[model samples]
Target chain A: MTDCKLCSLEEYLKLIEHEEITYAQPHKPAIPGHVLMIPKQHVAIIEQIPDEEFGKMMVQANKVSMALFESLQAQGTNIIIQNGISAGQKDPHVCVHVIPRREEDGLNFLWVPKTLNEEEMSTIELRIKENLTVQLKPKEVEPPKPEKVTDDYLLKQLHRIP
Target chain B: MADMSPEQVEELKEKLKNMSPEELREFQKKQCIFCHIVAGRAQAKKVYEDEHCIGILDINPANPGHVLLLPKEHYAIMPQIPDKEIMHLGITAKKLSHALLRALHADGTNIFIANGVVAGQKAQHFMIHIIPRKEHDEVGIDIPEKLLSKQQLQQVKQHILPSIAKSLGARLQEQPVAVEQVSPKEQSAVPAPRHEPREVVIEDTPRKAQPKAPKKEHPKKDQTKDEDVTLDDIADLLGGS
Candidate 1:
């Protein structure tokens, strides 16, 4: 079995408890009020995450945003998540970046397009479509089921009053 | 603000029916009902809502399912809003698109945002238009020619590169792993494919091929017309040319 960094969903949730490792909470010693929202399941990309989980993630992200707004006195908040290497995802783990923004803070998020021509665009689109289509198809053979873990324990550990 | 009473809503509708375009524009300027809806001061049949924005039906719609996605906060143009806001807006728009697809049974939807005066932004308030389209419906909007020549496009790429690089550098400094660095070499190396014109052949039902035949030519002397018959002669004959 491949040793995936994000092996269990509960373990991943626990990682967020330590603000240093998870970076999903406000008041990290180094970066001020950086929050991350990730799926409880091992999903590589936003598209792969189930719709229900995606909705839950958004709600959590909103909560983080509200927290950041209140604590940091942030003018605005930026929610970003990179999926693959091409999209700047350094880690294989899927996570969202909730960075607080302030006026003239000099944080720029302009996408400098390397001007893809029609063919390159088509090729890239086709490649993405192929990968997504494969992922979307229902598996004929069921993979080994993950061990059932109680959500109460995970929730109690993850949620903290700050 | 409280919800309008039935009588009040009826009166409002009556007023709307009587009002001219100028009056409507003035009304919109003074206090936009849509803005009031976003601010939670007015009631609207909201299609979708998130923390940042809300999608509502266009009362006088171009189509049945036409909806406008307006930000809670007022921003005149796309550039004024940060990329994060744009991303959030996009996500919200995507959700709305899905809902519209399911509810309206639409074939597809056109998602467009008009920015600034040149982009045909009628209202001073910024909004995104999500027009739900049905098959064979006459939504007669012409697509304008916004294509740039290859040379012009290259020039634009050249012009924005410095600023893009600077911004990327600054962003990296702030959040080290925030952005993916894409090199120009990798970008330029990929070539676009060209499409060739296709030859179309149409089959006809049992048409007979005709054989060519020689034709006799008329004498050149007989073909010549008399130059003496002028417009004056026609006038003399029938008082007409």
Candidate 2:
């Protein structure tokens, strides 16, 4: 964990720093204005992140996207997450990539559509629907606790009266 | 229809130019088939639907089980979306990705958003493309890496850093992580604001907006029932220009 690059993002050019998320430039960017929104905690993948934290990350990502448009005058932006190794996640620590794109930026996020037979499509759909359950635990808020006034103060006052 | 007459094309362009931004947005929404799908005017194989979002099967998918999750509200680009909706989209994408991983027995998933035409946005309405992936799936999302020189990096930083700082104003109370490591004394120069203990955060309102109503989940048995034949071409045609 000590060696994780994202745990210590001090080397990178920092943009916006929140309590949970840190937006910074990649050491080797896909594009010039490309920045990464990384969680401060060492979460390996998206699944490991709490729902509220994930939502917070997205909020920050949108902010950075806006900044890309306003500050850099970027024509477009791609907010991409490469989840696992096969999806091109290099670091164990999950980071959301916000790349500022333009016409023919030489970036290839485009993929050719594969032809799936009816049976394959149906099976995939059914499987996903059956397993797709979004159980978002509502955020719990702690109520304010009133400060306690102890009777020990009265005894201390009596001693001081002498 | 692919080849329009020069005069006809010129006429359409002139008509478009005269419309105000609001009118243009309405025009874009009218032309956007995804908007039509959200409105229930167009047929779609919907996998999931909430008050704020709709997840539909992408007919022209990079991989099978590819889902295009969209906001119910029409927005041309990501920058136009409000923070609340953006948060909702993010959480929804995460849920969809979780489902894709578990159901498809896939190695991984990609949550991709194309914000503009240059970013490969085919539909004017912003949607997050959640694609389930496997090893050697031939889905080439491999972005070309460019290493910027020190001077070039500084220039890019100078351009964007201040605006982000200003936007985050009072929210940011600490120095950059890098700055803190190098000069701890300098951190003290910037007075820290008194951190207030946050009160009870009301649960987001949209969920309550449909509290008693059952979630609208349409799991279609017949994948091809009442399919709009022209639906497939709309994406192609809109992105053609």
Give Cα-based local distance difference scores for all models: 0.46, 0.73
Off by over 4 Å in 1: A1-162, B1-30, B140-149, B163-241
Per-residue accuracy of model 2 over B1-241 as CA lDDT, tens digit each: 2588989999878989999998988888888899999999999878888999999888889988999999998988877888889888889999999999988888999899888888888887889999998998879886666676655555566556655655544244443221111111122333322332234232232222322223112111111111211212222322221
Task: Give lDDT tens digits, candidate 1, residues A1-162.
Answer: 145454333222121322112322212211233345555456665545545455444444444554444433455555544444433444466776655445454344332222334454344334433433454457799788998777786677677635
Give the CAPRI rating of model 2. acceptable
Candidate 2 lDDT by residue in tens digits, A1-162 = 798888887457776676767878876788777888888889999999987788878877777787777666668889899999888887888999988776665776899988877777777777777777444445678998998767798788888995
- DockQ of candidate 1 is 0.02
Q: What TM-score, computed on C-alpha atoms, does each candidate reach?
A: 0.35, 0.73
lDDT of 1 by residue, B106-203 (tens): 65555555543433455667676655556655553222122333333223222222232232221111221111111111222322112212232222
Best by TM-score: 2
Once fitted onto the true fold, the runs of candidate 2 whose alpha carbons sit more than 4 angstroms away are A133-162, B1-3, B20-22, B170-241
Docking quality class, candidate 1: incorrect
Task: For candidate 2, give the lDDT of residue A159.
Answer: 81
